[model samples]
Structures are given as C-alpha cells and as structure tokens.
Target: MERERMVRKTEIVQVLRMKEGTGDTSFAKTAYMARQILLMTKSIREKVMKELYYCMEQPKILCIADLGCSSSVENNLMSVVYGLIDTIDKARRELGHGPQEYQIYLNDLPGNDFNTVFSSVTRFKDNLKEKMGDDFGDCFVNGVPGSFYGRLFPTNSLHFVHSSSSLYWLSQVPEGIEDNKRNIYMAKTSPPKVLKAYYDQFKKDIWMFLHCRSKEVVDGGKMVLTLLGRQNSDPCYSNRTGYMWELLATVLDNMVVEGYIEEEKLNTFNLPIYTSSPSELEFLVHSEGSFALDQVHASEISWDANDHKNRSSCDQYDFAICLRAVVESLIVSHFGEEIIDEIFKRYREIICASMAEEKNSVDYITISLTRKSRG
Candidate 1:
C-alpha cells in the first residue's frame, strides 16, 4: 500500500502541469490575474526593492528566483524577470552603484513547458538591451525543474525569491481522506477529520518548503508569496470562489451517475490544493523558525477579472477556459483526456448559473518574509 501511494505521487509529479502554448486556452492568457495582483500590490514592490537594495550593497552577481515560474509562449517568465531587473536597476542608479550582474533562476515542476521559456530568452535579452542601452547588465536566466517542497538550490545561493499563484498546492493530496467522499476539497460537508488531515498536510508541506528555502536563500534575503487563500479561519467555510472544487466534484458526480465515469474513481479523487487562512500561514512561519514574518495582506479578485468591459459577452466562457487551463492537467491525469470537453462543458454551465446567483471572487494572500541570521 505504501509503494502504491508512492507510485501515485510519482505519477502526479510527472503529469501535473499547466496547459501549454499561447492559445486562448493556455495558462499564459489565464495567468493575467496573477500578474495583475503582483503588479498592483504596492507593498510587494516596496518589500522586493528594499531587500534588493540590501543585496546591492554587496558587489557580486545577485541571484533571484521565481519559484513555480510556469512557462508560456507569451514569455510571462521574461515579463516577470524584466520587471524585477527594471526595479533593481532603478534602485542601483539612485544609490550611485554601477551596473550589476544577475543570475535569474526560473523554477517550476519537471512537467513545466521550459522550452517555451528558453526559446524566448534571446528576444528577451535583446529587448532589455534596447531599453536599458549602455546601462544593460549581464543577466543569465536558467530554468530549474523540481519541487519547492525540497531543495532545488545550493546553500546561500538566492537573494530574492518570488512565487505567485503557487504555494497553495500541497506536495500531494492529504492522506486518509477516503471518507471525504463526494468532495474534491474541504467543503462544508466534509468531516472534521478530513479537514484536520488537509491542514496537517499543508503544515507539513509548508514547513518543508520554508526549511528548504531557508538553506538556499542568504541571511537577510527576502521572499514574497502570493497564493489563493480564505479570509475566514475555518478551512471548510463556503466562500463563493472556494466552491470551484465543489462544482467540479458535482460535475464528476453527475458523470458518474450517467455512466460516463466510475463512482469509485470519483470517490478516490481529491485535489492537492489548499486555501489557507492568514492566521494559519503566520503560525507555520513562526513554527518553522527560519524566517521572520514581515507582512501579510489579503485581497479578493473576481473570477472574470481578466475580462475587459467590452468582452463581457463571453465572460462565462472565458472564466471556464481560464479554470480549465489551471486544472485540466490534473483532471486528465486521473480521468483521462476523453471526457475533458464534457466535464468542462458542464463546469461552464454550472459556473454561469452560479454567477447569476452571486459574485464569485477568490481571496488572495500575500506574505513577505525576511530570512533570519543562522544561529
């Protein structure tokens, strides 16, 4: 049984990834919400630059990593790197410092579409040079493929670390959740034990993540993480956006009833995602004892946040497509690609119906931490 569970985990690691390419269905298009959150958060910018300025006091190549830096043909990875470099360069000029060299590591799971990210590097570099002219610094971008729950970098290697729309994903589905039954996540109907199991899994994964990063990041370095979260302390609270997993569970149940999918398969399936509360996040950071919690901010974004006012006509379809880009890989890993269209079709219908009744918005939590000096 243990070996079987390990194999299942291996399969998940091998299969779980965002839908690739630059098409409408790709994560690149859907990821605008994440980018928007990162750009709009004034505190995030301030914290990043403050720590970067501290790192600039040293006269060496600065190391910056974007954990969970999923790729896209649209070069979303490059866009983020560009923003960071621009900010750092501006700070350097104000301090009367010379141009600095940078080592940018774009990290994601092995299943990520790294080819797309690497292919855009030359163009990205050229554009940077054109914009910065004589002040262009030597920037080298490399892709690191692995899980952040474990070590992915050498000790004291990273100066700044940023992760957006990630970290809510536990290393794997919480074990002993077989009794969770019809729900894919911790719903209001879930048993107390199942909730505890999920929270425990989150605590374990997050502690390991912090431990690994504490070793990789230099003392006094900084990290900012933005992830889907809930404002309420209870994990089982029924927020409208938290209903996304429940809606998927309902669709699977319907398919099971209609003989499109097996009942047992639906019973066994569970999403590895968790929406943590700010209190919960703070507790883990303190308990980990490696980093000092700097700031915690929570905000909400609507399901169709990326849609323009003129594009309201197809908001429902666009919302469904965006969700599909995020979860299609996991669904395909379990249920096969055969029913992908039908499942998302029903998902879209349900979303449209639900949206009419109430606005669906997800809570996002941004946490900034500074690495403490090693004892």
Candidate 2:
C-alpha cells in the first residue's frame, strides 16, 4: 500500500464547499443534486430505519449523524433528518413503542456555510410543529465540523449514520502517482501506478472511516452510505464513470491548444476523486472487521439526472451550472478565477456535442452496514 498523504485540513475545508450564496452560483439554488441524493438513497434509508427500530431497545433518545452534509437552502438536511424521524416514528408505532426524542448531528467540513444550514432550523422546527402538533418529540440539530476519516464523536454515541454522494471524495489526491499526465482523474488511459495510488487512498480512507465509526456506534448500529460509483469491477472503466471528467478534460486540453491555458498547468492538474465498485466496497468492509455489509445496491442515473426542471431537453448548460456549483471553487483554486466562466462555457459546448452521440450517465452505490458486536 502507498503511504498516506494528507490534503491539509485548511485547504480541504476552504475549497470543498459549493459556491456559497442564494443566487445562480449558489448550490442552494440548484435542486438537481439534492433531488438525486434523495432518490438514490430511498431504499437503504428505509432499511436503516427498519434496523434502527430493532436496535433501539430503549427508544427514549436516538443519536444520529449525517456525515458530509453540505449546506443547502431547500432545507434538504432537515428534510433528511425529518424523514429519518418519521421513519423511526412509524416503526415505533408499529412495534408498540412510544414517542422518542432525537439528537441529530449534521456534519461537514469546517468551511461549509453552516450559517445557512443553521438558519433553516427555524423553518424545519416550524414544519415539525405543524406536522406532529403536540405529539412531536424534541429534535435538536447541531453542526459538527470535521472530517469522518477520524473520530468525530464519543464512543457508543451514534445509533445511525448516513452519508450521501460524499465518501468517494478521497481525503487527498493520491500522492505517489501525481504524473497522471493530461488527466484530472483516473481515466482508462491513466497508468497502473495512477490506478494503484487512488485505490490505496480510497482503501485507507474507508478503513479509517469504518474504524472510527465502529468505536462511536453501539452494537448493532447501522450505517447507510450512497457514493458515486460504477457497476464494473475494474477501476479503469472510463466510459462508465469517468466520461464527465473526461469531457471536462477535453475542454481544458482544447484551451491549451488555443494558448488559453498553459500546457504545463494542465499536465499537473488532477481531480481528487475515486468511484469504487461494489466488490471493492465489500472487500473493504470485510477487511475492516468492525462492520458487516448487509446490502449493496447499484443504479445508473442520467448525467443530467438532477436537472429535473429541464428534463424534456436535458440542456448541457443546465448540467454545467449544476457541475459548476459543486466544482467551481476547486477549479478556481487550481486554474484561477478569471478562466472559470470561459472554461464552463466551453465545457457546456463539449457536453452538448457529446449528448447527440452518447447519453452521459454515472453510477451510484448505496450500501448498508451493521456494526459488529464486540466480544
């Protein structure tokens, strides 16, 4: 295995957030990613709720954590929290248990726009009051700022853990193999060393994540995670998972040709992302020893899946905006802010051209894990 290299916490926190604000650049304004997250996690979410019902022998207070929960204005975080609560509440009624209070923790990198997240609480609370009336159990939501690669809570503190579209982000760009020339991610053309570097980083990060969660979750606790992934077992299946990035790379390469970007700069740029296969996830779970893989579900969603408002035509510019909200900060940090607009403009054209020949898509994996009982 390659030795681990850390992307400074300060650096990660600063560049990782969606463009913050309530306008066109803001992630809060984009509903596509949020909608798709809910759609993809629907099944395991219910599974986790069912597991929570049986695990909660004394259902007075339940502690739940949402990791990598970026800020959103649609009150997406609270909706998820409430959804979990509703599921648990329904299960409680069915199991002959009484009402219960909840201690919900919403976690993200320290640089996330938590002010926006906290502001939604008032509306969230108001909605709960209207929905449950006097029967509403107390729900307290707090923001936890840190990475999940290490312990973030007290031992035996969590009952359920949920993450969506987050884990595939490696803690850092793989260190030993930075010479993945002319590519921002592990493409089919990426060298074997590049592939091994990403695999090592992902394996290390997942193992550390499981190790920390094992100590924090009580026996039989459940974790549900939805990650950007591919159905193919090979990490180098470019068409399956790397097409979007590949397209983005094409835009950059074209810019380099036109002398709009420095060729040297393009050579050094690499995206710190890895999409794992289900077999890889299963292997990590079994090797970690503290978690048992209960389910692995894979599905393909359109590249423009989140552009619900423009579903009829599937415009590439709309998809560019969605991608911009999530990745603009990183791109700006690497390539400078001045080129941001031009880059996406060209990227939109590339996407539009490609759509005629190929309908771009990405795969997702939703997995449920049960905490192993300690001997």
Candidate 3:
C-alpha cells in the first residue's frame, strides 16, 4: 500500500509542479507570513552550528538533506537554510579557507512535487552565486521522495539534515480503532483512543527516523527538525481545541446514517495529529539508539496565512485541500482516489462551519539532534 501511494503522490506533485518564482508569494520573496517557518527550532540550529562550524577538523565538503522538502520554493524554510549556510561560510572565512564543496539534497514523499523544489533551488542557487562566487563551491542538488523513517540515502554519507512542519503526520492511521465515529481521532467528539493512536504512530516514526540517521549520517553530523506541534497531546475532546474532529465526525456520521457509506468507514480516517511536546521527542531520542540530543528548544515559527485558509472554518473543500496536499496519499489509498474530490467537498462543509468565527493560527515545534555515533 505504501509503495502504491508513493507512486500516486509522485504523480500529484508532478501535476502541481510550479516554475521558478511562480509558487506562493513568500516562496519567491520573504514576507511576514513566509518568515513564520523559522520560529520552531532557531535556537537549536544556532547552538549546533557553533559546534559544527567552530571545529577545526570539520570536513571540507558538506552534504545536506531537506526531508519533506515538497515545494520548489524555499518559502520560510529558505531563511533557516540560507542562514545556516551563511554562518558556515563566515566561520570558514575566519579560518582563511572554505570547504571545497557543498551539496543539498531535497527530499519529500514520492507524491511530492520535485519540479517545484528544483525551481526553488535554482533561484536560491543563483542568489548564493551572486553573493559568494568562489567560496560557495559546487552544489549537487537532487530530489529524493520516500519515507525518511525507512531508508533514503547511503550509509554514513549525509553531513546535515533539515525538516520543517512535517514530522507529526503519522505514517498510517491505526487499524480497528475507528469503529465508533465518536471515538475517532481528527473528528469532533473524538475519543482519547483516537488521540492516543496518533501519539503512538509518532513515537514509532520518530524512532524510525532516528535509527535511519544512525545508519546514514556520519558520526558527529547534525540534524535540524522543525514540526507543527502543541505543548501537550492530551486535550479534552471539545471545540476548545478545534472543530476539526467534531465537524468531521458529524459529516461522516451523517453520511453513514443516510446509507452513503459503511459504519466503519471512519475507521479509515486519520487526523492531522500535528501536536507534539518536548517530552515525547526526548523519549524517542533516548530509546531510538541513534542520534544524540544536542538540544531541544521550542521554536515559535510562522507560515503564510493561506496555510490555514480552509482550516479556518468547516469549509469541507478547504480542509480537503490542506489534507490533500499534506496527506493525499493516505486518502487515495484508503478510500479509492476516485472519491477524493467528493471527500474534500464534504470535508469543507463541516470545516467551514467550524472556522467561520476564528482566524487561523497554526503552531509547531522544531527539534535539533546530533549524529553523535552511527551504527
């Protein structure tokens, strides 16, 4: 199923591919909204850079990987990346010699649009060349779309890794727990079972990611992970948190009541589940037997306001757009891609009703770790 959806995601990304300077406004220019992505993990990245750049024995070449780098445009993430690179450049200059080469690997799920990423990289590359000609070195950039938790690169090869606003997404919704719409995760009146399911999946995936890095990243290499999250995962199932689950549950329940779908159909549903806390992340680090905890500071980052356009209310269509872009593969594989459009429409109806009153404010956390030792 995973492999099948991977192929489908690749197709969607290709279809939505944007040209250089043609994506969201912030992708090409740094706007207030675009600047928001840097909030979650800035402190950790800065501290890690000190250790990375200050070392006299640093490698002459750096290989970088941006996991979940779906958009061609750098958007808000560009700031963090460019900032990191510029800092390293400065440190090298102080030493009177720069690295011989540098490369960045942009990765996303198979369904992600590489063309968009390509254009973004091209524009950013030109910017770098204009500013620092000889010192910049060679940049070999390519797209790798696959689950980072499993495998994506060769052993002990990567120098650095960065991911933002993506990790909290679970690989799959837990099986069998969705029998009751009221107890489902991502729905209104969602039971604790649903939330717990998501938490479990996150723990598994984070562990997988850490272990994968242990095999692929060289000793002492660095990683920066910034993701959407909450201070705690356990929240009462009520509108106080979000109408997402409530509205979704209502929509699905109505559909079942009208004989539009099966009773357990909601079982296939998975919530956005983006909330994560520092403690959850720390446990993964210690038990995963992979990356070392260099630091775990909370970054308060931002994103373009459009990121929440549909989530702003119960607009089923808008919710679908956000869901499709973020988790389209899951939807297509589970419910049959044929009904994806209808699903979005139904989703928007419920979401718009929920978000009609309040403005959208999305919050997330960014964590950075060091590849202290690799297996």
- Kindly list the per-residue Cα lDDT of model 1 for residues 213-238, writing each as its tens digit: 99999888888888899998878765
lDDT of 3 by residue, 24-66 (tens): 3212332232234554355567667757767536676677787
- TM-score, structure 2 vs. true: 0.93
Whole-model Cα lDDT of every candidate shown, in order:
0.82, 0.80, 0.60
TM-score of each: 0.94, 0.93, 0.75
For candidate 1, the per-residue lDDT at 218 reads 88
Give the residue spans of candidate 2 off by over 4 A: 1-10, 73-75, 305-316
Against the true structure, candidate 1 reaches a TM-score of 0.94
Pairs that collide in candidate 2 are 184-271
Per-candidate clashes, comma-separated: 0, 1, 32
lDDT of 2 by residue, 47-84 (tens): 67777676669556799898987777345655577788
Off by over 4 Å in 1: 73-75, 306-314
* Top TM-score model: 1
Which portions of model 3 show Cα errors greater than 4 Å? 1-35, 39-47, 180-196, 233-264, 272-274, 299-324, 332-360, 373-375
